[model samples]
Target: MEASPSTQSPATKARLRTKTGCSTCRQRRIKCGEEKPACRNCISASRGCVWPGPEELDRRLRKFREQLYPKTTAATKATVIVNNVTPLSPTLLPTDIFSLAELDLIHHWLNVLSDLLVLPNADPACVAGHSFETLRMMTGCSGLKSAILACSASNKSTLSKDPRYQVASLRYYDEAIRYVSDAVADIGHGSKAPSDMLITAMTYLWGPDGELDARKHVAAAITLMKIRYQTAPKQICDSLAASWWYRVVYESVLYQAFFLAIRKPLSPDFDVDPELFQLQGESQHLEPFATVLERQPLILGLPLSLYYLMIAVIKTPQLPEAQRQAQLLELRAELALWETLTDDDKPDADVHSKFQANAVALFVLATSLLLDQMCEQCLLAGSPAELTTTSHTRWQVFAALRLLHRPDVSEMWKRCYLGAWPILVVGYSAHEEEHISSIRSMLRQMVERTGYGEFQRILEELEGLWASKR
Candidate 1:
């Protein structure tokens, strides 16, 4: 073996390589004088002087396709996909690349959105009263930061409605994908469990537009959790287990409901017979992480339980008539039981408590939304097989809508960044014209007051649904 010639000396390496120039100027054998970022020569020639990163950075020459997909968007950058490699995936960015505005956005996500989501959004560090820099200093992970920046941009886009925020949102979203892919890739090559920050950030990305991204991160988080289920150090395992079920999974469930609202109908075809599947319950065993459910709060657990139960009820197209009716009765009884229990939880001043109370109520309303329809199909279905003409249907849907607007609800929206989907879903399913009018009025008010693109989008979707119904 040509005994691998000894490694080249640093002096020799330095002498052999030119110090600095834009990749384009270097390729063209021209003097670059490396004008800081872009080369003067490249600037004069109207070509991009892609600077390689500080590490090795022979630098890049931006091609036409770069604008097609940017790593991050400026307030003024054109919005489009960066043809980085794939549309769904982009290359990771260096951690230190954030500008002041980008940094501010990231902090906003940390202090506000992350704090609100502490219960269900998986932000393990309930970072209140802390600066972004402080948190960054305490725990540093590029993948987690990238994910946070992505969510911040996405949330900002909802509030700003500016094309720039949309551009930024897309940019950060791709950056998050790239970062996570690299982190997971490292794990595949022989790393231990992924950073808890990545799991925390994954839960924050739960929203209408980012559900698939959220799920992608979740799948990876679950894998790591399973791999370390038995063998990891207790400290590491505890970090992963801290509210892992309550924050990570429950938050995803909430977003899943939001995303499904306009994208597809929640229930399978009403006419099809639902198969036998375990209904969601507070008591079910989740492999490797049973403690999540075992210890989850009823405030959160109640809605989650309803979500599963409701999902089952809507799919009851082929059920044995007797069993279907019995299940419906059982669910009704459960809803009533929860309502009675939650009365004790409904405090007057604590916004967090109020929000949770309202959330539980919304779950019941959402379940009722489907149950009403399911019950109306025929004599075999139940007594009231028609939801369209029922005054009770109007009242139930409207009641849910009102709970969402209670004084504390707006506070919940400000902090948690909850979407308007569930509120609108109840309205969308409302058959009463008066109830429908109130829903429209409520949505319009929310959009005009908040300028949140989500509300505006909800308004547009509602209109579309109404148009189709008409």
Candidate 2:
């Protein structure tokens, strides 16, 4: 063995496993160099080089802190005050302003606000002080914070069944609405406020008085958005702020308003131009809500807005099939856009995914509308067999019915039912048994979840259609 050592070949080296790419790159199925500081691939692509693991970031932060202050005391750490009695001004900004960290803080507060609005037994007063502090820290404009605080306070009191609490809640809602209105007015006067401020204001206004003055507020909000679209920079106008997301929120407000407006008079004073209200391509003359989705594809508001827009249109008599088809095509485009954005391996992938799900739900709604249109056309043309030809018409309708009952489809059902019910009636009358049975099952599920009035109306409509057939 000693003699043969020089002649013996070197032992083969073990194969080394290379580290995989960052999470974002892996998700996108892209190659990554996985370099330090910033990944080479991300830098080359001009994208953010976010690491794969939060643990790595946490470790780095801990190490940095240790290096900065080896003997730092507990008292030196910043403490966020959950409760403070100081009244926030309507137009003041915190000293440390303008950073991603600040934006995250604002988002956190908004989440808390959302939770307070929806969560049963959530204490509004306990949250009020924190809300005020959060508003103060996040917004430079004191008026905006005050309005947010007012809404936060109102959300707390509104949960109570007692008349006193109800009154208090209304008062808070009114105060918040007024402050937000003032802020909006201030923006019109050349104040450099973010467009989101207006959205937040509208949210609070509708949140409280949705059952009262939603239509009027919705109209006002749309007018404001249109004005901004016209005058704001082209970049801002072309961006998400000007797009369907804003319109979607407006549509939601309008839907609530429509429900309330049913009790109000439909005189010349409240009349809007029918053509202008149609959901079609963007135009200056169109209702702001209708154009929002067309302008912004990535915004979650597009689907919601489309859902409500369809509801509004369906309630009206004599909607042209051509127009409906055009709108459905536009919604399909929006869904495609949402898929593209969500599929990107970006930091906001989770949010984009949520938005994609919402878009799918909206697509389901659009399919339902298309189905309704097809059924209506069949009835009008006296071609009963055309309704169940197993072609695009029948399949689309069936697919929509299937999606309507899906767990992920709940958010848009209220709007879906508005469109679906009419189609169901027409289908039942035409003796399309398969479609009728499917729609009936979906409606039954809806009855358990929707309000009493809506459920009763749908049931009555179904019964009346059946009686007419008999």
Candidate 3:
């Protein structure tokens, strides 16, 4: 009782033919001799050939499979249940989703930017692995990805002197700002603590123009730390100390805060709350803080204790004259101790470590000189011995600067842009023409070598200072 095949409806017939050929062949309504890259039919017809891209093809195949075999049976349901428990597919990770441009930026980050961001002494393999893991965890998150890309692009702009790179960086920064703002707002609503990605993104929101107020970001980061984890100082310290990335970011924030506090303490826009970072009463927490610094000595190429001393100096201005003088002397003694330790250790350390030691020593010496000047200015009197000591420290600082300028550490200096703050401090404290000239030359070379335009701002500020002094 079956109907004849010729009379059968077209819908009842099986479809064995696949539309895998070029678009030209498909559009022409002709059979296509499917070929890789180009179909023979299109070639013969002298037509342009275009095929589905990988994502399109994948979507098409997935749609076809789903349509062909719709799940129905109990066995199918059981299979789905098992699949739910399986590990995430590799395709779901960052690699499969990144655009070509994003991939190139990531490659650059892995090769260069990672070195700039991580602990200087951290193993490259370990840092790369950590970065990869971070990317994987943040696969679909634009905040971290955009931040990383923005940083890379900004650096590229400086290096290549291409304004287009800066434009791209700004675009990425804008996108990242949207995501980070949302996250921060959510956290403000008592959603949860900020993630590592969010924290890291906050750290990277700065641009070449130096328009961003770093004190704001630093304060936000510290505030989040306090609000999220109201635990004892030890628990907080332990958690942060366990992760080198956290430590690096924290140290960087501290470095920026110290620099801003020292350079523009009274500036309205740059003002930060001393209580937010007050460690004076956290005597029990000092051990943990010291432990972290001991383990990651000079990660950002500055003595951690120097930051503490800066905080002490800032706090001392509010104290009684006698107490302030006592604290200043104590700070001076600590600076002297650091200078001695770094000098003794420099000869036995590696080139990178030696550079760090000298960099820290340079800052210590400069800080000592500045502290003496503060005493002389505030008291309007300085003993003959204090004047001699100040002169000696200035000479020692210049000597350390010369050591840093040596050929052996040229490559080291080029890689370490964190030297910017120390260099600026030294430049600000320099009085002699020869020392000022040396500092100016070093700043220009640092800007040229590291491609950090922020240093250019520092150079300009120093120029203004020198002009005023003249």
Candidate 4:
């Protein structure tokens, strides 16, 4: 074979030449330009540029470090010197058990999820340190961290239509449930007072977009708050400056309870908690718990009057028929008081709803319609009052739909989460094909922008309702 040497170069014969290249090129056993985003080979082939994930990179780095400095002490392994230049320490790398994928999800939480959880704050100065405070609260709780990861993953799945993230979301969700179960078991021992952190963990476990049942998570949060109120009544009365729990736990539980009330009607046999009613009564007072009564930054913001009224509505189903009707009338009056209030001392209704189809107005109108519907369901249908209620409900539905189609409100509706309940109410009451189509379009746009699949779920329910009507 001393014949003329082969013309081919050694580079062409190398088997591991593209080992550090894009996944597709490496699989194809070809040279890669190693370009970012998309390599030349992938672009030409019209293939996706799939890079190694964080976990894979972490493993590769660990393997390299071990080979370079095997079985070394901490000091020796701390820094790896190269050609008289000091290199970054190996310890500086992410060496913890928490994978980089989860870290990315946490980053998503900081950037997007937190903002989605609440309406814009009225006072920007008060929220200047909110991020640090939230991190401190989440630092020690594994269950809370897992719940957050689960939510983040679910959000990503919705946006990207990726099956992998959904799988990961479910796994983290199951782990969170197990951790919460263990924590509840520990609570039976009275070893720890139900702190706001633990209670907040329960609040985060409510999966709005996932397939998991949310009722249990909400019930757990309510139970934990009840425990806290019973065991540490003093803590409940503390000022916001003294304890952040007063705002976080109270508002979170209240918001969840409000939605639960809307979605699942209370059974006649369900017992009303005495503390819940006490909280409702105290919210109407001017002093003592005035700060508690005042609306803080919340997921749902309503007039102080409306907030209290919703709590009563949530409990109304538990009352006897005669008493329930009386309570409903009382709530209707209270709602009217807020809607028409122009007293110097009272909150201006316009301040809450500047837009024709603003969230607050939509909510008030929707709640009004809901109260009337409940009355009809619970009482005999032939009363003169029934005609007025039905007419008023239809009027509110048409008003909401008209406002919804305006140019200005269309932009607002794209970003607002609070419109959800009202939109659902309008969708349910809507019978005409045009009206139904408009509501469906708005929901689809919201899902496209926010990646909140809960809207999609609502859309599905509305379609099912429409199908039945046809």
TM-score leaderboard ranking: 3, 4, 1, 2
What is the TM-score (0 to 1) of candidate 1? Answer: 0.59
After TM-score superposition, the amount by which residue 275's alpha carbon in candidate 4 deviates from its true location, in angstroms, is: 1.6
Q: Residue by residue across 178-284, what tens digits does model 2's lDDT show?
A: 76677667776885643655654664465444445656766665556555545563544354343433333334444433434322211112333344344556644
**Model 3, residue 194: C-alpha shift (Å):** 1.7
Task: Give the lowest summed-lDDT range of ten residues in model 1.
Answer: 82-91
lDDT of 1 by residue, 213-302 (tens): 444544455555445443454544354356343334333433333233323234342221111112344523232233443344421334
- Models 1 onward score TM values of 0.59, 0.41, 0.68, 0.66
| Model 1: lDDT to the true structure | 0.50
Residue 136 lDDT in model 2? 43
Better of 2 and 3 by lDDT: 3
The better candidate by TM-score, 2 or 3, is 3
TM-score of 3: 0.68
Cα lDDT, all candidates: 0.50, 0.43, 0.60, 0.59
RMSD of candidate 1 to the truth, in angstroms, is: 14.0
lDDT of 3 by residue, 284-352 (tens): 434455457456543545655676675555455556776877777777777677667645654566865
